[model samples]
Target: MVVGDASLDIDTLVIGAGPGGYVAAIRAAQLGQSVLVVDKEYVGGVCLNVGCIPSKALISAAHQYETVKHASSIGIDAGEVKVDFGKVQAFKESVVKKLTGGVSSLLKANKVQFFQGEVMFINENEARVFNEQEAPRYKFKNCIIATGSRPIELKAFPFGGRILSSTGALALQEVPKSLVVIGGGYIGIELGQMFSKFGTQVTVIEGTNSILPGFDTDMSSLVAKKLKAQGVNVVTGAQAKSAEQTDKDVTVTYTVGDKEEKVTADYLLVTVGRRPNTDGELGLDLINIKMTDRGLIEIDDQCRTSVPHIYAIGDIVPGPALAHKASYEGKVAAEAIAGLPSKIDYKVIPLVCFSDPECASVGYTESEAKEKGYNVKVGKFPFSANGRALSLQSTDGFVKIVSDADTGLVLGAQVAGAEASNLIAELGLAIEMGATVEDIALTIHAHPTLGEITMEAAEVALGHPIHTFVK
Candidate 1:
C-alpha cells in the first residue's frame, strides 16, 4: 500500500461506477480479484441518480394521480384528485436515495474499495485519480471503463433557465402549465407523457414522421393515441430551430412543412438523444486505445477494447444505451477477465418504453425476421379482449408474436398494454431458451391475468387461440 503521492497497486480497477462499472466491480471481487471502483459523483451513476430510477419514480406517481381521476369509469367513483408537486418530488428523491444507498452497502459488503474522484489514464497500466485537492496514482493489472453517456445539448437550445434538458426537467419543482418537448424518443415521450398526466399541456415536436422512431408504428401509435386522449398535441416532421427564454416562459421556434411557427410554453425540454462520455479529460488517446469517429470505444465480443487487459462497456461501447444491457455486458466482461468462457451474445436484448401503455420488444420483429430471410408468421391479440385488461379499464393496446411459419419457432414478440414491461420479460426468456410458439402456448398461464395475454398471442401464432376467434 502506498502513502501520499505514491502509486498503489490493485488487481482490478473499475471506472465510472455506473451500472456497468459497479456490477463489474462486484463480480470481479466475487471472482477473488481485489477490486477498486472510482467515480466523480454518486455511486449509482446517472441511471439511478437522474436518468432511469428517478424518472420512473416520477412516472409512477403521475400514473397513479392520473388513474385516480379516471377511476369513475370503472365504477370506483373516486373524488377529485390533485397533485402536490413538492411531495411528488420528495417521493422520487426518496426512491433514488434508497436504491443508491443500497448499492453503496452492497459494494461494502463485497469488500470492494470505492473512491470519489475523476480518472485520467497515465498509461495502459497506470492512471491518476484526481479528487478535490490532490491526485493519487494507481497501477492495476486490468481496468474497465464504463463512463456512460450524457444528454446531448444542442447549439440552438443550451440548457438553462426555461430551456431544460432531461436532468433539468426531472429536477423541476413545479409542473409547468405548458411544456414543449423537442424530441419524441423514449425519454422525451416518457417525460412528456408524465408531465401531461400531471395536468401539463405538452406539445411534442418530432423531427421524424412518427414518434418513438425505434418502435414499430403499431406500438408507437398506441402510445400516441393515449397521449392524444390525454390532451397532448403531437406534431410530426417538426424541426426545432431555436428557443427564446424569458423570466416566466420560453418560446420555441420550429418549422413544419414549408411554414415556420413558434410556440410558447412554461419550459422547453430537449431530449434528442445521448452522446457517449468518451471525449475530453479521460485521455484514451494517451493509451492509444481505438475509438470510433463519434467518440465511442470499440470493444470485441467479450467487451475487450483494442488494448488487451482493458475492457469497455455501457454507453462508451457500441449498442443501445440501456442500463440492463450495460449490466449484462458488465457480467460478461467480469467473467471473461476471470478466464471464464463468456462472450457478449445480444440475440435477445429486450427494449422497453414506460409510456402510457408501455411498449416492449425482444429478439426479432416481424420485419426484422423477414429481412433476415425467415418466413414470418404473426399473431396478434388485443387487450380489448383480455378479461383482466377490461376489468382494469386499461385496454388500449395488444400483444403480437412473430414466429417462423414452418417451424413455429418464436422469433420475436411485442407487447403494448398495461404491465407490458413485466410481460416482455417472459418473451425475452423464451427467446434466450429458443422456445417455440407451442412451448409458450402449452405453458399454463393463470387465467384472468396479464400473462394470459401473452399465452393467447402465442396460441394465435400457432393457429389456435382460445380467447379470441381467428381463422
Candidate 2:
C-alpha cells in the first residue's frame, strides 16, 4: 500500500530536520522502521545552527567581557579588557558547525535516510518533497510533521541592514554601538542584555508594563530594575509606530501614553514572537487534520493528529516553542508510532532565559497555582545572602518556590540569578516527583555552592532557613 508520497518505500517519514524531526527519525530507525527525513534547510534546524547555540555563544562572550571589565571588584587586577568581534563571531560559528555536524552524524550512524527539500503533505499517507531542481514523492505508513517556526516579521519595520530579527541579530559581524530592541520577551531581553554587556548602548521597548511578560509581575519588575542598573534603557507600555533608516542610524517612533517619542540607534532587533510554519497548503486541509485558530496543528496526548497514522510535533503543534520540548515530543511520537505507550509530561518542561543573570521556571507559577484553586505557600531566598554568590560577586537575584499549603508538594519554582538555568533541573524533578518542601530542605545541599539556595528556599518555606534569618 502506498503511504503519504516517498518515491522510495519507507515505513515512517518525518518532515523537517529540526530537533524534533531528526530526533524522531533516529528513534524510529532504532525501533526498526525504515525512516526518511525531509528538510529544506540546514539539519539540526534553528536551535543548533542559529537560534539557541548562536545566541548562547554571544551570551557567553558577553558574560566573559562583563566579568573582565569588573575584575577589580572581585580582587582580580586584570586591566584594560578588550573585545575582538571577529574572534567572538568565529567562536560562535565554530560551535554551531560542530553541533550541526554532530546531528548529521547521529542520523547517519542510525541509518536514517535524509532528503534536503521542502515537504508538502499530499494526503494523510503521502507527501511531496521538492528541491530547487527536482521533486520527489514519498509514501509512508506513518508521517511526522516537525517543521519549526520563524521569527515574526513586523510589517512596519521591514528587516534590512539596519533593522533585523533574532536570526540576523545573531549573525552580526561586529556588535552595534547601540541597539534598539522592539520586544521585551525572553528573546528580546536576553539578546538586548547580552548586547548591553558587550558595551552596546541598549534600549528595550515593550508594549507591556515590564519585561518578560510571561513571568510574574514581581519577577519582571525585579529583572527590569537589574537591567536599569546595568545602564540599559527600558521603556515599557510603549507601542512602536514605524522605523526610519539613515546612513549612520535608524530612528524608531513609538507612542507612550498620550505622547509620541523617537529613539535613535545603530541597530534594531525585532522579536515580537513566532508564528507556526503550517501554511494550510501542505494538503492538511484536504486530509482534515485539525488546526487551532493560530494555525497550530491539533494533536492528542500521544502526539497523534486527527489522522490515525499521522502525527505532529514541535513548533508545528501547540505548546511552548522550545527545542527541548520539541525534542522530547519527537521521542514520544516515535515511541507511540512504534506501538509503545508514550505521553509527554508538559508540566516538567523548564523555560530558561540566558541573560547575564539567567532566569528559569518550571511547573506552575504561584499565580497560576492560586488561580487553579491551590492554596499556595511561597518561599524565597536571595543570592545576596548566599556565600557562593558573595565569592562569585554576581549576587543579583533570588529563587522563589511555590508549594501546596496543605500537601506541601512542590508546585513550581522560579529563579533569576547566576546559572539559574542550570539550577532549575532539581526543581523540575521536585515538581515531577511531587517532592515536598521538607524533602528538598532535608536533603543537605553541599556548602559554598549555588544549589544551597534551593535548599535554603525550601527551608524558608518550612519557616526555618539557616543561612539567612527570616522573620
Candidate 3:
C-alpha cells in the first residue's frame, strides 16, 4: 500500500524497523516528510521481539521468585515458591506482543508506511523490497539504515534446543535442573544467575580471568563475590572445546590452563558477544557504503553515509550496539535529513547490565581516565551504608565516582548494586551538563532514596563524605 503525498513522493526511506530505524522514521514524519519503513522481520526487531524486552521480563520474574524465597528475612512471611516455566514464557510473550503492538501503532500514528520484506539497495537513492512472492523497487530522497546485530554463536557448539542462544534460552519449556552457561559476559551471567535462583545448578565459564571483562577489575570482582555467595560456580580463564548432546542432557568439554575438564547440564547458554547484522542480500556493496574492518557501516558524526543522502545508525554503525544509542543516532540522522544540524555526543552514552543487582556506567572508567592522562580521583560508597538499600535488604554492592582531581569535575560514574540502571540516568545527565563533584555533593538528595548514594559518592570524592567514616 502506498502512503503519504503522491504528488510529493517520499522524503525519507528507513530500512530495518528496529529502535533506531523506527525512531528515525517517526521523527522524519513528524517533520512533515513522507516516510517508508521496510523490515524483513517484525517492526520492533530483536530488541523488542527477542533480546532486550523478553530477557528483562524473564529476569524480573526470576528476581521476584528469589525475593519470595527470602521474604521471611524481610519480615514478609511467604511459603515455598515454585516456578511454572510455561507461565513465565507466556508472560514474556504477552509483554512482547504489547510492545510490538505499540510500535506498530506509533508508525501508523506518524503516517509512516510499513512493508514486510527484505530491502536491498539498488543504488544510492533507490532500494528494492522483496517478499516471498514478489519484489518491488522504490526510489527515495533519503534513507536510514538501522539493521541491528546478532548473537555470536560459538563454533564449538551451535544453537539448538538444548544448546541455546540468548533468544532460545528465553523460551525454555521448563526450568532445567542444571544449566551450564558457556560465556561469562553480561548475558550469560545475568541469565545464569536468574536460573540459579530458580534452583538450577548454574556454572559460568569465561575465557578471561574475570567475568565482566569490560568493567573495572575491583567492581567486577565484587560482582563475582556476590555470585559466589549465591552458589554460582564461576570458572574464569576457561575455554570450551566441544559439546556432545544426548537425549537427556548436553556435556560440555573445556580446558583451563593445561588441564581439560567437562561439565554436563540440562541446557547450555552461549553468550560470547554480538556481530553486526550486515550479511543479508542487502546491496550495501552495490551502493559503495564504506564499512569498518569489523563489518560495521562507517558513518560520519552526522550519521551520514559515504552516499551523502543515505544514512546509517545503531548496531550496524561502529559504536556500542545498544538500543538507546541507536535511538539517539536515529534522531540525529532524522534531524539532519530535515535540514537541521544535529550530532550525537558519543561520550555521554550510558551502558547498563541488568543483572539481579544491576551494573551501570557512563563516560570513562578510572582506568580509561588514567590512560587518557587525566589526574583522576576515585570515590566509592557501599550500598550497605545506605539506608534505602539496607531497608530493601539488597546491600551487596557500591557506587563509584571518578572525577578530574585538578578541576573537581565529574568525569564518570559506575554503580554495581540494586537499581543501578535507574541510577545511571542521573550520572548520564551529570556528565552531559558538565556538573562538578561539588554540584552533586551539594544537591540535597532525599533522605531515604537510592539517589543519596550518588551524593555520598561525590562527597567521598571531595574527601568530606557524610554517613560513613572516611578512611
Candidate 4:
C-alpha cells in the first residue's frame, strides 16, 4: 500500500471488507488473482463486529441467566440469580476479538492484502483508498462492491443518549429497568426478549397486527405466546408517533387505532430495518453503474453489475441482507472473476432468528409453496411429542415440512423450537439436494433427539407418523 501520485495495479479490488468483501477477496486470490480488499472499518464487518456475533453472544448470556433463575421448576434449587452486565459485555467482546483476529489471519493466509480505509471509485477500473494520514491510488482490472447496510434511524426518535439503534442497544453498559422497543420485527423481538430475560420491563410497539409479520401465524404465534409468558408487553397494530428523551429516561408516545398512548422507559430502541451503505462514499454515479430506485445496486445471477468488470453483492444488492447470503454471493462473484460459471441459488438460503426457542426457515413456506403453484403437501410434528424436547423441558414449538403432493419433493421446511437454528440446516440441505419426504423419512435420525421431529414430520407427510396417532 503506497501513498502519493503513482497508482498500484491489481487484478481485483474489493471494497467494504465485510463478510462479502473479505470472502470475495480470499476466493479471488485463491484462484490466482492479485486481490486487494479495502474497507472503512474492521475486517469482519457488522456481523462480526456488532451485528450477528455480538448479539448472539449477549442472547446466549441472557438465556443462561434465565435458565438458571427458573431451574427450580426442574428440581434444581438455584437461589437468587444476579446479572453482572459489565462482565457479559466483556465476554461478548472477547468472542468478537477472537473471531475478528481469525478473519484477519485467514485473509493474510490467502495472500490478500487488506487496507483499513475507505475506497471511492476513481473510475470503473480504478479506486482511491484513504485513511486519516495516508491516501493511496489503485488501478484494478475488476472490483467487487460489498459495502453492507446500517440500521435506519427515525427522525422522531433520533439515536444518541436515550434513543438507541440495534448497535447502540447491544453496546449498553447496563441493562435498563424499563425499555420501549419500536418495531416487533425479528431484531426488535430478539433484543427485547434478551432484555426481558435480564429482568427489564420490555414493551414492544409494532405497526402490524401481529409480531414477526412476514412469518406464518402458526410459527410467529409461538413466539408471541412465549413473549407474553415472559411478561413482554406486545402492542401490535400500533404506530410510534414520537418520543421525548431526558437524562433519566425516555418517554415514547405511540398510537393504537384512534387512541393515543404514552409509555415512559429508561430507553427507547428503534429496530425498524436497515438502509444500504450506497449513499455517500463509493461514488457509484461516477462509474455510471446502475442502481434501483430503492438505492440497491442491480446485479445478475453471477453478482455482476452493469459494468462487466465490476460486481456487487450483500446488502447493497437485492435480496435478504443476511451475512451467509452475502458470503455465498461473495464466492460467486469471485468465481465469476476467475472465469468460472458460479451463480447464486436463493432457494437453499436459510434464515434464522435467535429469539427465545429460536425460529428458522428455508426455501418457501407452506403458503409460499402453494402461491408458487405447487401441489403443496404440509406435515407438522410438535416438539411436545419429541422425547428430547420433553426431557429438556423445551416443548414449545414444532417442525413443519412443506412438500409437493404428487412428487413428494421437499419444497421447504420450518422449525420453531429448541435448536431450531441448528436443525434448519438439514432441511436446507434436503431442499438443495432435491430430496423427497420419503428420503428424509428413510434416513434414520438418532433416537430421542430433537432431529427426530424432522424425520417424524416427513413421516407425517408420508402418511405414517410414528409418535402421534392419526385418524
Candidate 5:
C-alpha cells in the first residue's frame, strides 16, 4: 500500500504512450486494473505520429507520383504530373492526426488515464511524473516500461542545419533537389527511395556490400535493381567519414575500399540505425533494472524485467524493433499481470519491408532452415508467372517457401514482389499451424489472383507444378 500518498496509488503505471505502452495500458485496464499511462510527448508515439504511419503516407504519395509519370508504359498517359509537396505533407499530417486522436479516444473509452509528461523512476514501485508545471509522485504495484527508441545520431554528422534524421526527413516541407543518404538499411533505403521517386537525385552510402543488408542478397538485389532503374547511386562497401555543410548545400565524404569520394547534395539524411532510448533523465539505473551490454532491457517470456514487478517491451527490450512486435509483447505483459498464462511465441513473427517491390519473410529463409540442420525444400514461384501480378504490372519478384524435405513441413517463407507484405501472412500462418507443402498445394487458390502463386510454389516443391514444366 502507498501509505500517506493519496494521489500516487494505482494498480498499474505505464510509462511511454507508444504502441506498446498504450496497448499494454488498455489491456491492463481491460483486465480490471486502474491504469495511468504517461508519455513525454504524444499518445500515439513514433509509429503513428512520425515513424511508420507518416512514412508510409509519404511512400504512397511518392509511389503515386512516380507511377503517374510512367503510366505511359501501361497505356495510361497521364501527362505533366507534378507533386504539390504542401498537400503531400498535409495528407501525412491528417493521417497522423486521425490515428493519434483515435488512440486518445480509445484510452478515454477504456478509462485508461493518459498523462502527457515525463516519468522518472524514483524507486522500484514509485516514480515522479510531470511536465512544465507540476511534479507528482506515483506509486504502483506493477509498471510497464515501453520507452521506445530514438534515431541514432552519428558523431561526425550531428542533426542540425543540413544534416537530418529520419524524423527531420519525414518533416521536410519541400523535397530536396539532391540527397545523400548514409546507411542503406531499411530506413535509409525506404526514405532514399521515396526521395528518388520525388525526383531527388539520391545517393546511398552503405558500409555493407548491399542495401537492406539484413535481408538476403537475392531479395536485396531486386531492390538495388529497381533503384538503379530509378537512377539512384548506391555506393556499397563504403564508410562515411564526415560531413561539411553550407547554407546552400551539404557535402558528405566517404571511403569505398580506401578510395575517397565526396558527394554534395541539398540535404544529408543519416539513417544509420536507431538506438534504444534507455539513457536520459529517465533514471532507469536508479531502480536497478537489468539491461544488456548494448543498452537493451532484459526481459523474460512474459516481458518481465529482472525487477519482477516491472516489465519492459518494444525497442527498449531485445528483439526486432517493430511496432507490431512491440504491441504483441505489450499484450502478453498485460495478460501476465492479469494472471493469464500468456507468453511470447516468436516462431512465426513476420518481417516486412515497404520497399519498391516490397519484401517480407516469416519463420526462416532457405539458408536459415539449412543452417538449423533441416533438410530444406525450396518452393519458388515468380510473380511474372502470376496472372494478377502481370495484370497489375508489378511482376518483378517471387515467393519462396522453405519446407522440411523429409516431412514437407513448412519451415519458412519469403516474398519479393507486389503486395508481398500482405502475401507473406498466409505463409506465416502455414508455419504457425505446422502446415506442409502438400497442405498448401491441396488448398485451392482462386485463379487469376496473386495467392495462386503460393499454391503453385507448393506444387513445385512437391514436384507436380502445373504452371511450370518440370524436367
Candidate 6:
C-alpha cells in the first residue's frame, strides 16, 4: 500500500479494459461478483481504439473509393472520384467513439466500477492504481489480468517521426505518397493493401518466401495476385536492415541474399509482431506468478494462473493474439471464477485476414491433419464457379475443406475470397460441434450464394460434386 492511500475492497478486479478485460468484468458481475475494472488508456483497448475496428473501417472506405473509380466496366459509370482523407478519418473516429462509449455504458449498467490508471501489483491480493494525481489501493478477492500486447519495435527501426507502427499508420492525417512496409504478417498486409488502394505506392519487404506466412501457399498466392494488381511491390525473402527518416521522407535499407537494396518512401511502417504488456509496473514477480520466458503468464484450462485466485487471458497468456480469442477466454475466465466448468479449446479458434480476397481458417489444414496421423480427405472448390462470386466480380479464390477420411468429420476449413471473414463462422461452428462434410453437403444453401461454395466443397469431399468436374 502507498502512503496515505484509501483501500477499496472488490470481489473481482480486472486489469486492462480491452475486449478481454471488459468482457471478463461484465461476466464476472453477471455471476454475482462485485467487479472493478481499470484501464490505463481507452476503455475499449487497442482493438477498438486503433487496431481492428479502425483498420477495417479504413479498409472498407478504401474499397468504396476503389469501386467508384473503376466501376465503368460493369456499366455503372461514376465520374472521377477522389478520397477526402479528413472525412475518412472522421468516419473512423466516429466508429471508435460509438463502440467505446457503448462499452463504458455497459460497465455502468453492470455495476462494475471503472477506473483509468496504471496498475502495479503490491502483493498477491493488493494493487495500486495511479494516474497523474492520486494512487488508490485496491484489495480484491480475485484478479484477472487482460493487458494486451503492443507492436514489437525492432532494434534497427524504432517507431517515431517517419517510422510508424500500426497505431501510427492508422492515425496518419493524410495518405502518404509512398510507404515502405517491413514485415508481411496480417497487420502489415492489411495496412499495406489499404494504403495501396488509396493510391499510395506500397513496397512490402518480407523476410519469408511469401506474405501472410501463416496461411497456405494457395490462399497467400491469391492475395499476392490482388496486391500486385493493386500496384503493391511485394519483396519476399527480403530482410529489412535499417531506416533513416527526414522531415519529408524516409529511406529503408534491406538485404536479400548477397544484394543490399535501398527503398525510399514518405514513411516506413514496421509490423514485425506484438509483445505482451506483461513486464510493466504490474509486478508479476512480487506475487511470483508463473510466466514463460517470453513473459506470457502460464494459465490452466480454466484460465487460472499459478495462483488459484488469479487468472490471465488474452495477449498476456499463451495463445494467438486475437481479439475474438481474448473475448472468448475472457468469458471462460470469468465463468471459472464463479465456479463454472469453463475451459479453453484452441482447436476451433478462427484466423482471418482482411486483405483483398480475404483469407480465413479454422482447425487443421490437410498437411497438419496428415502430420498428426489422420487420414484426411481434402476438397477444394474455386470461386470462379460460384455465381455469387462472379456477380461480385471477385472470382479469385477457393474454399478448401479438410476432413477425416474415415468419419468424414470436418477437421478444418479455409476460405479465400469475398466475405471469407463472415463465411468462416459456419466452418468454425461445424468443427466445434463435430459436424461432418455430409452434414454441410446435405444442408440446403440458397442459390447463387457465397455459402454454396462451402456446400460444393463438401460435395467434392463426399465424391459427388455438382458444380466442378471431379478428377
Which candidate number has the best lDDT? Answer: 6
Candidate 4: C-alpha RMSD after superposition: 0.9
Separately for all candidates shown, the number of backbone clashes (residues 3 or more apart, or on different chains) is: 0, 15, 0, 0, 0, 0
Overall lDDT per candidate, in order of appearance: 0.92, 0.90, 0.89, 0.93, 0.92, 0.94
Measured against the true structure, the TM-scores of the candidates, in listed sequence, are 0.98, 0.96, 0.96, 0.99, 0.98, 0.99
| Candidate 4 Cα deviation (angstroms), residue 197 | 0.2
Output the lDDT of residue 270, model 4: 97
Pick the winner on lDDT between candidates 1 and 6. Answer: 6
> Which candidate do you rate higher for TM-score, 3 or 5?
5
Query: What's the C-alpha lDDT at position 41 in model 4?
Result: 84
> Any runs in candidate 2 off by more than 4 Å, and if so which?
1-6
lDDT of each residue in 237-303, candidate 5, tens digit only = 9999999999999999999997999999999999988899899988999999899899999999999
- RMSD each, Å: 1.2, 2.2, 2.2, 0.9, 1.8, 1.3
Give the better candidate number (3 or 6) by lDDT: 6
Candidate 2 lDDT over residue span 1-471, tens digit each: 323333666899998899999999999999999999988888999899889989999899898898889889858888799889999999999999999999999999999988887877777777777777777787789998898999888999988979999999998898899999999999999999999988899999999888898876666777788899999999999999999998889999999999999999999999999998888456778789889999899999989998889999999898989999999999999999999999988998998888757889999899999999999999999999999999888788899999998999999999988999989999999998989999999898899899999999999998888778877
**Tens digit of per-residue lDDT, candidate 1, span 195-255:** 9999999999999999998887899998988899899999999999989988999999999
Per-residue lDDT of model 6, residues 132-195, tens digit only? 8778898899999999999999989999999999999999989999999999999999999999
Please give the distance, in angstroms, between residue 50's alpha carbon in candidate 2 and its true position after superposition.
Answer: 1.1
Positional deviation of 265 in candidate 5, in angstroms?
Answer: 0.3
Candidate 3 least-lDDT 10 residues: 1-10
Residue 261 CA error for candidate 5 (Å)? Answer: 0.5
Clashes of 5: 0
What is the lDDT, from 0 to 100, of the residue 404 in candidate 4? 98
- Stretches off by above 4 angstroms in model 3 are 1-9
Q: TM-score of predicted model 1?
A: 0.98
Q: What is the alpha-carbon lDDT of model 2 when measured against the actual structure?
A: 0.90
User: Model 4 compared with the native: what TM-score?
Assistant: 0.99
